[model samples]
Target: MLLSRKAWEIDLREARKMRHSEVLGCCPHDCQDGCSWVAHVEDGKVTKVVGSKEHPFTRGVLCAKVNDYQTRTYAPDRLLHPLRRTGAKGSGEFERISWDKAIREIAFEFGNIINDWGSEALMPLHDMGSAGALQRRALMRLFHHIGASRLHGSLCGQSGNAVAAEGHPISFDPETLAESECILLWGANLLSTAHHHWHFCLEARKMRGAKIISIDPRRTRTAAKCDEHISIRPGTDAVLAAGMANVLVEEGLADFEYARSAADDLDACLEEIKAWTPDHVCEVTGVAPDDVVRIARIYGAARPGTLRVGIGPQQSRFGDVFVKSLSALAILSGHWRLPGGGLSIEGYPTFDNAAPECPELSPEGTRSLHRGQLGRILTSSDLDPPIKGLMIWGHNPLVNQIDAETVRQGLCRDDLFTVVIEQFMTDTARHADIVLPSTTQLEHFDVQGSWGHCYVGLNHPAIPPLGESKPHTEILRFLAKEMGLDEPALFADDETIARSCLPDGFDWATLNQQGWLFAPQPRRDPASMGGSLKMSMGLDGPEDLNVRDPIAIGKLRLLTVKPHYLLNSTFANMPRQAGQQGNPTLEMHPADAKSLGLQDGDRVLAQNGKGTLAAMLRVTDAVLTGTTVLEGKFWWTANEDGSPVSNRLANSNWTEGGQPTFNDIFVEVTATSGFADI
Candidate 1:
């Protein structure tokens, strides 16, 4: 009675065939890469994930992270149902609950908190996790409608962006880099950190004959491939850059006429940088004085040299100062306006895309909360009130932020009610009183724009959301409705949201059909500057300026560093990536390691006045002898036995950008009694 094998297979396929349809979609993942992908659907299920050859940004290729779309969508660890904590907080105990009940409970508690402590008590900590335009806007709108406490200040790129805004705000198109003769890659390890850009850089080096100069504290993959690698002392990037400028001026390489024409106060800037001579810079940066001269001559003399400044440069105490100095260099060399020239603070083109006016969410008139003050907020000192309720989505601050112990204590507060929306049970999720399951990129429809490239991409739903999982926008809508608020204004469908957010004169339907969009060419010269120094600086030029005193003498700042790959802790749960480097470690020079009576792989305790974390020593000449490098991606949670590591030691000191100089806080390291298992 058994059917033939071929017959059985054919019959099974026929039985499963419910319908076939083509949909226009884009991958709405948190990555800056923003890949455009196609979904093959049969019987309401995604059968294949393919790159859209037509996508200008993706260019018919996908990364290893996105290639496993099926696995990530169907991962066993994904939250399939809403749950409420049934045990003590941080106990990781929960009970399954329906979505309706979960929404009602969340709304009630959130409303109560707002009534008692004002909207600022309920902080919604969000990041790139749910980057869809609708999802992001909906959350902000809901918070505004509910009068809930809001989170402000981006942990990423705010300093760099501010500096860029102050100068020539526009970004250079990525395609333009291919035409450059020389590229100065500073602090960024594009090869391992940004894979797609790494490919372009490699191509530019080998095929286009572009000379690449890498400047970083580490001998990264990007540095390895460069024509020359300049390893400077960490946190002293500004000093080195200033020295390079000094060399340019001294060697008669400065484009003084260009600076006078392009800058606001060329004489003041020149005077400020004059004291930063190569000899003085050599003493501070530890780079050879002659190397400074060589780099300045080459970078200044090269006809279309481009400077690509990495996010790492802005993660320290004087991050903003460093960015400003770098911008000043570009201005002095007349590299700010030319094609194949200028500096790139970040490769992402999303900044160039016009955003709707969101004045309510703006930081104006709001009491600022610096990211480094997590401990104080949790502890509820006399100066700061306790965070009564917390709503976290798309970001994992407990795992990523410095001073894990303080954050853990803050989350452990009995008075605090925490809600977490996530795809999986992340370290941050473990502390939540309520957990809402969220949909992945494969289960949603959205448009994506890259910070790295100019092209915008559209995402189509590749599969039905797994189990009861819902998109963040849906969750926001439900919460808004439950709170007795008008939900339409807060939540619009994906297509409508995308259309509204797109630049003027662009239609959503047209974008969907084409699967991408591009902005019009930028005007080369605005005619505002009349090619004269007097016109550029306006009347009363150099005498109208007031300069500040120089930085005081002190120990060089040593801040914890994180690359774009592990920006915060969102990606830590991805086994293939995070498991390879389980916890944060101390990166030190061999001489420094010896000075501290430590060796490679030895366990050491890195501590400041606020906290401490156990770290394994990794000795290399890449790090400056006086400084220590700690990758900032460790869960603040206690181990299986309830012991904390690196998060315990993060400094809570503040910096100008509302972020702590976590890296700049000097620490004393001592060899542990026992070495780490690694």
Candidate 2:
């Protein structure tokens, strides 16, 4: 195979004697902060990686996970060549094969599946594994041209983005948080998930003496450092927002003039929330009445404040309502009038409409499949033509998705043809009939947009494809030729795709030198945001509130939270990351632990109708009374002792939009010495 001309081909011994040179790049993982990084290469070897100091958002700082990216790129276990399965599925046995043979077999098998079971029988499962527009979208062109079933909606943030979009909420630059007088972090755990965004919040506290408040079910690392933390029940965020609005208006603290001018449905919203008294809200949300009143007063008195809403709370059954209600609270408070005041929800700018999904290229009227229901799609009996072929790239559904066991069972089918493209053998990859080695961020060329901030940065190839590994685009190009597909979108060169996706006026040369550029902001007039308030006013109390709270009076709501050591399941296999993350533990309140006769560090099994998981107990007051926390992603199903996977207890339920309801699960805890019966 002919590689890129810019590829590095020097040996390590020769690299050691050469001077160091810096190349600008962007982090191509599934992160809100698409951090700008500088790779310091000595001849051909990357000695170290650091955050780009010139970038406005990154500001010379990177998260702990990306700080040691070189270790992951050069890990000993990375896949370097294509392999074909030679043993039973999930046996992790494979024999090396030439690239030409691998592509030919995949094309041939895909053609057979299409001819036998119809085009819809072929489906592709993917996500933000590679956030680069070129890399993430390149594979879709081939699938679209072939009329394969499409993966619809995101595994995360679909509901929130949909709800936020309907209201046309004004979004201010995140860097302006330092100018605010008050900041409310609603469901956002910045210290753990978004360190760079947290840095700006810290600047508000240090430079402007801004009062910061946290509202969540647990006292997270970010909440512990805030001025005050308010613990509340799960799935009741919308009601809490309504209560705050009631206090603001009823107590005569609301700015009537500003609210009237900003939103046309001010009176309608006021009447709708009149019955949501502080006491009634406290009963539903498990928050103190006085605490709600205090937060309302603080929010009302500030001239300019920011409401940073995280996507966690939006993964519930009524997630869209939660987002709409919070957005309404910002409207009633009249925060959009000031420069630093507005909502900070995700709105990633589309650089090029042509590169990403190429939704237009798909054969007209093809069936769309929801990603949250992967298990059902693979095992369902109602479909006219069942899925016979699955192409997975940049995503590990077996560990990341709910109902993982069902997905594993589907993959074990002898008739199903599975293909996986990855750098390492993940749990999902182990079940594949064909495994293709893919290049890392250091050996790829692409461009990416940020969710935490507005910058869109360029990614330069820092080194050559490690061994026989190839970029995702090149792999698809080879397959397209083997299949005799000649669509223009399928054959677009990597450089052409990358250049086309740059922000409106920016060129490749200037962006490469500057490292990053801020995205163009859209102008939104607050007076025209009346439709948002109208939607919020119709949000009556959820009917299922009472039934949703107590699963069985003794069961606890399971919260599988994100971990600081890994991004989804990306770096979980690295030795350094594995040590930092340690063993997964079940965090429960002391009262809850005592009721189950469980002690700290004791082995316990959390069981529900869906599945069961074994983890060490951690009794702490940080979590709420009827809630338990289990953090981090999974690399495999069980340990040598037969414990179940972390997502075993999670169901494949979805929110009102198509987002997964990962946190809307309940389980009962029991003491166990070992998982021998698992």
Candidate 3:
């Protein structure tokens, strides 16, 4: 058979294989897919990194963004040594510095900052950069040991996780979705952001014959591929859920038996939901009256349908309350009893407490800083003692954080001595006073657990450090020694730390042998759910759902849609990832585009006063007529002159959880004076 032309063009490599060994490790990115990956190592170098075919849930497939991470780790721009900044912030200029010198200088500066303004002045900004169980929270111990200021707020999945935790003892198991006869992907674009879970969703469709319904303002890939897509108004999720409850109770379709026991406060919840008629729901949510009845009928008709709520809808003012209302609606419809039927919140099982914890490091009475408000914390004069020094890890603030301009200004502060531990010269790293080279997951030895799937795995060193780079844990240990910290926990090696995180009799070798060990899966119905369902106030109906003008009324509500390839800003700097993303474009309904006197490909200015971003217009009716869609997370660092920058237009406001309200805003999109190709 002739080789396919496409296959023939594939670039082939012929690395000399001295000895090949399969090594297992887990992904360290802050993505929903927790992949148990396999590294094919030969001669102390990794030849290939692919998903572990043995991983039951992930089924050995990696997303487009992460599949080529081996190349990214070895990219020419990859940081290999510690460096001191030699140019203006964001200028990306640095001079190499020895590890000892860098550590000593950073420690000295940190001590001075602490001596002058107390430990609270020295802030550490870290996230799941390596997400290695050993590395994830390693810096916290150092910061806590030093009595640094505490960082608080729902920056990660905290907002959604908080609401779910209040009601459930354990997280709802997503694996049960395969048993679902009808699946509603609420606000989640699973195909793009959570690809691994999409497989089970497909089983619900092709195998179980489940009807899939997607509700969002834009025509996301997941929505476009689903059986039905509904365009709902932003922040009106509670209204739709409450309306569904009204219909379920009015038509006697609610699971009365399940509601009576599982949700004792059902009557009180119904009392509030009784006011939300289909018409009222339509008036508040952009969903039509008939669509509401149709969804309610389909959902109620199922023995117990499943509701998998996405984090996308939980970044608004009433995000927490919306979760509560959605929970009530699920119980009212008896959706929690089936294996694959229930509300799947953000959660993963535990194996010796996989999350990073250094609670002892938190000093009593320390001021708490919200991670999302980094901009405000840095720029606001009202701060009692402004942040004098900053240490960043894993996360890229210049692109991920809101108020891009504020972050830029804050990082530019001559007085703010910032140190960033990074694998590359990220947009955020460029703003640092001293940039420390950090190892990729391939060069780290640590334990890691998945928040998406039930798998606890280990990340063994697949290769030696490329340069003078070190793991976050090692760096923290070095700093602890430099600062004369006697805390034993502060200097634990990866093996010791990883071992401490597991329980007795845990098979340490299974992590590397099979690549993963399954944790105790979530129960179909747990008693802990009662507390949340019982304590929830009556559902918020149309009257309660009405959002007053958030400063103005006529402008279209804005939403950011993550491009299929670039899940976030992580791979934006990678050449291949950037090429796949192409130019940034803002999708608008044809009517909205016409209202702004713009056409397809026309450049438009989308500004909310706090920031101004520009993008080419894609005039399609895929989005709501009164809303615009900006695809993100944009490569702000790779932006060319006149290129679209989505974050520049974000309002930079904080949600109740302290996470940036990336959505939940309104903006005026006006035609630009001249068109420029992005």
Query: How close is every model to the real structure, measured as TM-score?
Result: 0.86, 0.93, 0.92
Mark the regions of model 2 whose C-alpha exceeds 4 Å error after superposition.
1-19, 165-167, 255-268, 347-350, 523-533, 537-539, 542-552
- Candidate 1 vs candidate 2, TM-score winner: 2
lDDT of 3 by residue, 408-526 (tens): 89999999999999888888898999999988888878787666766677776788889888988888889999998999888777777777777677887876567678775547463
Writing each residue's lDDT as its tens digit, candidate 2 over 193-232 gives 8878777788888987888999999899999989999998
**Clash numbers, per candidate:** 22, 0, 5
Residue range 1-678, candidate 1, lDDT tens digits? 999999999988877664765555665555555666776677777666777787665676766545546566777788989999999887889999999999989988988887887666776666666556654445666765455544555565666765554444335676677766678888877765556666556666676687889998777767888899998866677877787887888888787777766655677777777777888777666688898988888888877677887776676666777777776677677665567677765554332222321335434444445544555766776634447878887777676565666788888888889999888887778899999998887787666566666666666666779999988778877887788876456656656666656666665566677767665345232112443221111111111101011112212234455543444555555665555555557788787677667899887776557555566778888766666777655554423322334445655544465544445556677778653431
Q: Highest lDDT, which number?
A: 2
Off by over 4 Å in 3: 1-17, 352-355, 521-526, 529-532, 535-552, 673-678
> By descending lDDT, how would the candidates be arranged?
2, 3, 1
Better candidate by lDDT, 1 or 3: 3
Give Cα-based local distance difference scores for all models.
Answer: 0.66, 0.81, 0.76
Two-way lDDT contest, 1 vs 2, winner: 2
In angstroms, give how far residue 345 of model 1 lies from its true place.
1.0
Q: 2 or 3: which has the higher TM-score?
A: 2
In Å, residue 127's CA in model 2 sits off its true spot by 0.6
